[model samples]
Target: MSRHDYFSQFLHAVWHGESGHPLVASLLAQPAFAVYRNTIFKGCVDALSANYPAVRRLVGEQWFQGAALAYARRHMPDDACLIAYGDGFPDFLDSVDAVRELPYLPGVARLDRYWSESHLAADDAPLDTAGLHAVLASGRDVQLAPQAATRWHWEPAYPGYSIWNANRDPGAGPLSGLEWHGEGALLTRPEGQVQWQPIGLGACRFLDACRAGMGVAAAAGLAQAAEPGLDVAVMLGELVQAGAFTSFH
Candidate 1:
């Protein structure tokens, strides 16, 4: 390799901890560069931590950082000209054998990672049920956005969502009733905030129907089918209150 190319490779390695170069420690001593590197890693950790605060709290900051460091080290990423990384950390967490018992750990990471993307998504005005009632009044079939996701886990062990709900600081401790249970949710970045609204049985079934690529009318019918006594109007109200709708094509 040309001298310039070799130097560039070495620099990249040093930046990501891939190299055992003796100069690395000394270079890290330069307060400015160290701060820059720390910022880079901190950004990675913060994004991942925001999603995995429960894991971090459960494992402690030092342990979490150690994992993040090890993860960032292996996945140095080929795009050096890139602005950020850690896109692969979630899967990395899943692949590691040590954390196998943390079944919901990967899920938390996935949620956080998606939230990051949502934060960067195109701005959208979420659908409000006020208009939704009018839509139903108009009898038009509605559909959720491609960006939306929802589910009801019969097994409640995935407290991933609740952990995320708890503040970044672990002071609140695990969310009350920390054990997993049936949960319905709608995730969207309507109005520039990543909203994670927990849904009830009626709304959960309805949203799941919609998420399965079902039309609004069909999904609503399925929801009513499962919950025969569902108050369609009231359920729709609850959905609307949770920012259910967005602009139509």
Candidate 2:
């Protein structure tokens, strides 16, 4: 096999626990190779811990590390940027035997992923109230573009956003008295800091419409259709304040 092919198989063997691969069998037997393998495993576990702090917080260090190790064994990082690693972690949580009873764990992990993505997204100035008003004055046919750092998610079956919000902040008080219901979260980086807020289904649909490249009027219609009692004007003003829009044209 070519050197590249051998390297590829070596990586597969390391990640998948298949050390019997002929090309890597002798190397895997060396003591130093065991150290290198352990280092790789530690790096993956540490990166995953950082990427999903809320998960770590919810499950405690011991439990979280065990889960992270299992996940690392099945999936290796695709690139050098460890900050963006663990994209599949949320889904992986679903199949974990220990967390099968905790259905909300995956959703919380998803919000964690969204936070990381928003933090790394390219910078852009968000649309303020004045800019939104000017756009409305010009015409209603204009399309509003969501900010590059904008990320939103809706969980129709669980209060995932609420649970995530409670656990994300290290200094926050213990979560209590939460109403058990579906929730949606909207994340944006309007300035240097990432901001998040719980939103309703109407607002989530509105943002979805905007992301789909719909014009202002069409997006409003869709939002209102999803929520018959929705006040489009009020919702637009709230989103404008939240820096959901970047520009309109």
Candidate 3:
């Protein structure tokens, strides 16, 4: 086999815990190769731990590491950038037997993923009140684009945002007296740091409409339709202030 093909086979064998490959059979039998394989697994577990700190904090280190190892075995990083890894972690959590009792775990994982994505998103200036007014004054049909770092999620059944926000920090105190209800989370990187807040269903729908390339008026109407008596103007103002929009066209 070519050198490149040989190396690929070796890597596949080592990474997937397989020793049957003829090219890697001797290497897999070596003690040093076992150490190297373990190191690779550890690195993947570490990357997953860093990517899903909230999940790690929610579950203890021992449990999280075990889950991470299992997840790493089934799913390898697609690219060299480990920071962008674990995109399917939330879905993996959903299928885990241990996670069956914690239905909200997947949602929390998704929020953590969103936070990582926001942190890695490209820099862009968010729309300010003046820019919003200018767009309104133009009296032309335009669809507002969410900022590059803007990410929002709404869970219709679980208070995942509340759980995630409470456990996001290692030093955060124990959660108590939390009301079990649907919650929405909105994240934005207005400046350099990522910021997040609990949002309402109306706000979530509005952002969804904006993401779907609907005009401002149409987005507002969708929000109102989702939630009657919702103050679309107020919601719009709050979103603008939160730096959720990047531009309109």
Clashes of each: 5, 0, 0
TM-score of 3: 0.94
The sequence of per-residue lDDT tens digits that candidate 2 reaches over residues 101-174 is 88889999999999999999998876656766876877757788998988999888889887898799866677
Backbone clashes in model 1, listed as residue pairs: 126-245, 127-245, 127-246, 156-180, 156-181
TM for every model, in the order presented, reads 0.65, 0.93, 0.94
The deviation in Å at residue 148 for candidate 3 is: 1.0
Taken over the whole model, the C-alpha lDDT of each candidate is: 0.61, 0.86, 0.88
Q: Which parts of model 3 are misplaced by more than 4 Å?
A: 137-140, 170-172
Models sorted by lDDT, best on top? 3, 2, 1
Residue pairs clashing in model 3 are none
Candidate 3 Cα deviation (angstroms), residue 229: 1.2
Q: Write the per-residue lDDT of candidate 3 for residues 31-121, one digit (tens) a residue.
A: 9998998988898899999999889988899999999999888887788779888999999999999998888999999999999999999
Best by the lDDT measure? 3
Q: Higher-TM-score candidate among 1 and 2?
A: 2
Provide the lowest-lDDT 10-residue window in model 3.
14-23
The TM-score that candidate 1 achieves is 0.65
